[model samples]
Target: MKLIHAELIKLASLLSAWIAAGLATILPAAVAVLNSRSQVSRGIDAGFQDLAPGVIGAIVIGVVAVSSEYLVEGAESGGGRQITTSLTAVASRSRFLLAKAAAVAVTVALLALLSSAITLTTTSLTDETVSVGTADLPRVAGVTAYWILTALLASGITLVTRSGIVPLTFCIVNMSVVSVSFLLTKLTSWANYLPDLAGMHLFLRDVHGSVDIAPLTGGLVMGLWVVVVAGIGFIVFRRRDA
Candidate 1:
């Protein structure tokens, strides 16, 4: 509990966290409003489509949370990294990692819920044609879960690299408007199995072509990927010097 509390406090102190949280809350609404006004018609899955870019905020949150620990304060002075202090205080790498992950999970989950709600509400208000039925509840929940998993995926990747730039660049680029995965899907059906592509199946009801999998199965596949990468990160973090 103490470790988790400390981790939360540490996250709260970062400017990046505040920016990420704000983006997570605002981007969805902005996208929804744009979509509502656009003359081009979006199909039934418009809601999810508008909300998708908001996940970038969750990704940033995850990467920043872990990478901040490795930052050097003053190269000339040789001030130690924050990870050194964190490990010294906790005295257990595994415990500290767990606390960090827990803090990230909780924060991203709340952000996801807030973003989803705001997006859904904004979509309904701006576009009366868009439905907000109870039937869509599962899709909303799936989006929340997707954000949490994506955040964890970023966290795990950051742990392995010990730097935010690599994971953040790759994730944000791959998830952008001209997504690498989307382009790859045009070439090979197997691209559907990519982590982001597969996970999006959970909430995306109208994925036009490539490959189709059950929502639960897609979640499981993405979760497995996160577990494998996170496991490798854990091993490296345990054996490596802090």
Candidate 2:
């Protein structure tokens, strides 16, 4: 228990982690509120239903949280040697990783919950006649899932690359863009099978019947990605020097 707590503290000690988390939760929420007002004037009573764009910045947060660990150096900053020494003191790598993952999950989930609440509340306040209900639950869950997957992938990539900025760049430019477009067509079996494409279906449920992929299929695809990425990350973390 002490070790886990220490690991959590270590993860939180970085300035980037807190900054990323703050931006992830706050910026999107602020935009969601603004979008609600604009949508109202456009005869679109949907409110912040289209605030997904604000969440793109969240991927950067998820990536930076784990990557920042590699940058610490020397006694004052808890260098690479300190990490290995701490692992020895802690007695188990799995437990350390678990604690780190737990912190990541908790942070991302909280941020997502806040963002969703803002979106829902803003939409309701703006659309006098429109009432947002629990129907948004699935979409909210999809966003949460996206956040978790992003964190897991980022942590694993950071472990392998050891450069926070590099993995963050890939996540921002490649993963975000690629995932957004994974379900554009159904021509190939593999295209929709990708994780983001699958998860995106849940968010696009309003048009799932007309779209190439079904919501259930999208959920399944995202699930597979989560499992695969997490499994790989766990294996790598267990073997790495850390």
Candidate 3:
């Protein structure tokens, strides 16, 4: 509990984390408003598309959580790293990893919840074509899970890479207008199974290609990917010197 609390404190103190939260909360709502004002087509899934890029915030949060620990201070500060102090404080690698992951999960989940509410509200108000209602609740809940899983994957990848540059850039590029997954889908149906693409099935009814995956199945596939990635990260973290 203390370890988790300490990790939460560390996350709270990070300017990047706070910036991520603000970006996560605002981007979707702003997009939704713009799309609505532009009078987007009255499709059932019109506004939901705006929520996609907002996951960038979750990715940033996850990356920084792990990357910050490895950052070495300047020579004036004795060129020390936070990971050394963190490991010294908590001898149990398993507990420390769990605490760090838990903190990221909780923080991302809350941020997702807030972003969903604001974005959905903006969509409902600005886009008179679609009214937010009871039917939208499940999708709202799913986004929280989606963002949490995304954040975990980011953190796990950071653990394996030991730097944010690769995972962060890869993920941000994939979330951009021309996504690798989207491009891959043009060549093969299997691309739908990618973690980000598969997870979109949870909250999105209109998905890529003719592949029809149930929401539950989408969640499961994403979860399996997380387990695999996080497992590898755990093994590496336990075996490697901090």
Reference-based TM-score of each model:
0.95, 0.77, 0.97
lDDT for each residue of candidate 1 in 1-242, tens digit (9 for 90 to 100): 98999999999999999999999999989999988998877878877788889999999999999999999879774777899888888887889999999999999989988888889888888887887878988988889889989999999999999999999999998887567887888999988888898898889978754788788988998999899989999999999998
Instruction: Evaluate residue 177 in candidate 1 and report its C-alpha lDDT on the 0 to 100 scale.
Output: 54
Sorted on TM-score, highest at the top, how do the candidates line up? 3, 1, 2
Clashing pairs in 2: 198-218
lDDT of every model, 2 decimals: 0.89, 0.63, 0.89
Ten contiguous residues minimizing lDDT sum, candidate 3: 39-48
Which lDDT tens digits does candidate 2 get at residues 137-232? 777777776666667667766766666677676566654455434444445555556665566566654433234776667777777776677678
- The candidates, ranked best first by lDDT, are 1, 3, 2
As for candidate 1, its clashing pairs are none
RMSD of each: 1.6, 3.7, 1.2
Query: For model 1, what is the alpha-carbon lDDT of residue 220?
Result: 94
Model 1's alpha-carbon lDDT is 0.89
- The ten-residue window of minimal lDDT in model 1 covers 205-214
